[model samples]
Target: MKKIDERYIEVLDQFGFGLYTTTAGCNLYHDSSWGSYIVNFNGDDFVEMFIGYAETFDPNEYVSLHIKSHRVIKDIGEMLKSAKEIQILLLKVAIEFVKISKESMVKADV
Candidate 1:
């Protein structure tokens, strides 16, 4: 994904959405206090997720259904085929988000 800034990335532009997945997390790994995430596709390959802590820690929240460089989908079936991959990616990203937030909180206390 192309980095829009320190906190945002052009997810749609990166059709490699399904690449960052994990077995424990399908595509929706989240934490109650840290953050949440939802990486999926519709009109465009986008993400609705949050990384890091609250404004107190400068959270990185991505909530765009249609991000930059909308994909030219040739077949919906093709996308469906890779649902597992995408699911895994979502979980991985979400878990990472919560982990980062937790670590940050610990550091803040220190």
Candidate 2:
């Protein structure tokens, strides 16, 4: 598997989203929950981002941007398994939301 940083950058770049890191090493943005986030274990940094359309200006059109990243785990085989599992769960939920949104659009068209 690719390193976490490389994977993160690739995913974000592919989706055309920008990452903002705080002075304290946290990443902040809005997603499904408006405050959903993932934290980097190295520095306890967090990341979240999403895009939305303005109902007044573009009620019929919308844009979405998503970002996902993983923190480096020093002891992959031992120390941080639970953390990794939690991250995987979070990612799964995000993906499911995307799927549901797409399905809703299709149903609306029908």
Give the TM-score comparing model 2 with the true structure, all chains together: 0.30
lDDT scores of the candidates, listed in order: 0.35, 0.36
> Candidate 2 at residue 12, lDDT?
48
Q: Please give, for residues 2-105, the per-residue lDDT of candidate 1 as tens digits.
A: 22232223332233332233433224232212123343222222232333212122111121221234645454444443433444544555555455557767
Q: Summarize candidate 2's per-residue lDDT along 37-97 as a digit string, tens digits.
A: 3332224312222211111212111111121134443433332333333344445434544
User: Which 10 consecutive residues of model 2 have the lowest summed lDDT?
Assistant: 59-68
In model 2, the Cα lDDT at residue 73 comes to 33
Error of 2 at 6 (Å): 35
Q: Candidate 1, residue 104: CA error in Å?
A: 0.2
Candidate 2 residue spans exceeding 4 A from truth: 1-79
Q: What's the C-alpha lDDT at position 38 in model 1?
A: 44
